[model samples]
Target: YVENNLAQKTIELFNELKNPADVNKTLLNQMKLDDIQSSIPIYLSAIKAVSQIGDYSKAQSIFKQIPDSLLVENQIRSALIDLWGKVGSVVEAKLIFDKIRQPNIIEYTTMGLF
Candidate 1:
């Protein structure tokens, strides 16, 4: 869905898979290791889709759904920087960028584009 630029569809599918009732449960407690690993790609795709749709609020909402474990991943953080920049929030992007202990090429490239 993301590759095709189907932002809305991507968002819908993500929302459908997540159970709101599980809000209080940490992802680690709710899902297996494999499940979390597999969902990482989908989460990343959804972030990119949110950017394509230019829905800053939705982007933040989806961001809050992500497990803290995943947030530290460079790939996820890089995508977030791109998402924030696309949504007209350079400050948010910079904040995420600054948190990286050792930003990689992809992170630099994404942040540099802003």
Candidate 2:
């Protein structure tokens, strides 16, 4: 039931961050109590939430926990690219883009379009 808990916690974290009220970073810190290596999906979900709320500092902090190998995965890479672009770091986005191996047409198109 660990997976279930993780999924539920992830949803809670997303909602808390998405609320119009100010975010409580403490909540994020608490979420990090979960096993990060196994909870990459939840962590990534939090990253997306923070990014959407313009909380790049917190999002970057979470992103850093994801290893380069994980970052290379298509789904994660797309999120990171978008995050970097959202934060006005086109150079960083390009750096990640350059490191991608066998980028599909969608990825290529995203790079060109973004």
Candidate 3:
């Protein structure tokens, strides 16, 4: 279901479900594998959360888990670039920025913000 793999939806469900965090984490990961396309943002959010929690390695793994196709999308690429930048992932962020072709103003701004 779209509800399961969407980042906002996954986050929303996690907030609503008062079960153990492990349960939510497992469910989210399952949803991600089940729908990699829809799960791109979910993976990004996971990366952001892990990074914020001081788990840069985990965040990198989550970011790496994103499908290549999804990572090329404008919005998703921008988000990943911004995320890498904010987390001080210079190499990852630069690589992502370099891969963008014909980037628009938003993407330019996002890369610049790093």
Candidate 4:
């Protein structure tokens, strides 16, 4: 759905995966390592969709759904920097970028664009 540029549909499909209320700590605790790892990309896609909509509040909400373990990932933070920047929140993007110990090419490129 995302590849097709259907941002709303992508978000709908993502939301259908599980209830919003289940996206908290209890959900994280129930997921295995494999599940967490695999879901990272899906979460990233959802974030992208939210970014395309330019909804900062929705972006923040979708971001909060990501597992803490995933936040440490460079790709995740990079995507977030892009998302926040797209939604007119450079400050939030910078905050995430500042947390990265070693920014990669993608992160650098993303920050540069903003």
Candidate 5:
């Protein structure tokens, strides 16, 4: 079924995000974001990996490509915040954190912990 396929693809993408040295851009491009809200987790993981690898520009570009709706999630937004912070963009990170409607304790903790 399409649902099962999407789930599998999402898991694969998540694995790539966690270990971006193994990422295949061609395969990543095949994923259909419109069919999977769970893509947010993979996207966040990719952002973290890219930032850690000193590819902040690429991470920012990918973040920008994601829909505004997708960016609204706490996990995704938290990743963005962290990415911006890693790049020394504290102002942008603060702005994003402030815009979050209902930031949970984890979001607060992440901001402080980092």
Candidate 6:
């Protein structure tokens, strides 16, 4: 029952990905209540969808709402940086890079590509 509920929530949020601003964050508030990003796939999917449509600012806003502890992950940070760079937000990219706790080679390499 627990697994089914999570899967259902993910599906509901996936539909909302079409327009992130329209996303009812309340659905994902469980993560905020837990003081975590809660769902990596949701965050990544939102970032990817927003970036594809050239909405970096919206993506950044979503990324910012996620807790810093969860943001420490290289994949999440790198993906955000890539979105920033893609939309010519180099400063945003730099800010994210500086925020990394201890960026590894993959993070360095990913940022370099941006």
Off by over 4 Å in 6: 1-37
TM-score of each: 0.67, 0.66, 0.64, 0.67, 0.65, 0.65
TM-score order of candidates, top first: 4, 1, 2, 6, 5, 3
What TM-score would candidate 4 get against the native?
A: 0.67
Residue by residue across 5-89, what tens digits does model 2's lDDT show? 5666655765766552123343445545753443446546655765677665765676776666677678777777777777767
RMSD of 3: 5.2
**Each candidate's root-mean-square deviation in Å?**
8.3, 4.1, 5.2, 7.8, 4.7, 4.0
Give the Å shift of residue 114 in candidate 6.
3.4
Query: What C-alpha lDDT values do all the predictions have?
Result: 0.71, 0.64, 0.65, 0.72, 0.66, 0.68
Q: Which regions of candidate 5 are displaced past 4 Å?
A: 1-27, 32-38
Backbone clashes in model 5: 0
Assess candidate 2 and give its TM-score to the true structure.
0.66
Model 3 alpha-carbon miss at residue 96, Å: 0.3
Best by TM-score: 4
**lDDT tens readout by residue for model 3, 21-85:** 33334555666676543455555555556545544565575665667778778777777777777
Q: State the lDDT of candidate 6 residue by residue for 20-107, as single tens digits.
A: 5436344445546644445666677657766766776676567666667668777788888887877778888889999987888977
Per-residue accuracy of model 4 over 1-114 as CA lDDT, tens digit each:
344455574465446556332333233333333243336666776676777668777777778778789999887899899999999999999999999998889899999899
Which regions of candidate 2 fall more than 4 Å away from where they truly are?
Answer: 1-37
Query: Order the candidates by lDDT, highest first — what do you get?
Result: 4, 1, 6, 5, 3, 2
- Candidate 1 lDDT (Cα, 0 to 1): 0.71
Q: Pairs clashing in candidate 5?
A: none
lDDT of 1 by residue, 1-114 (tens): 344455565465446555432221222233333243436676776676677777777777777778788889888999899989999999999999999999999999999999
Give the clashing residue pairs of candidate 3, or none: none
lDDT of model 4 at position 37:
38
lDDT by residue (1-114, candidate 5, tens digit) is 145566676566657564462352323355543443436656766676666765656666666667887877878888888877777777777888899888888778667755
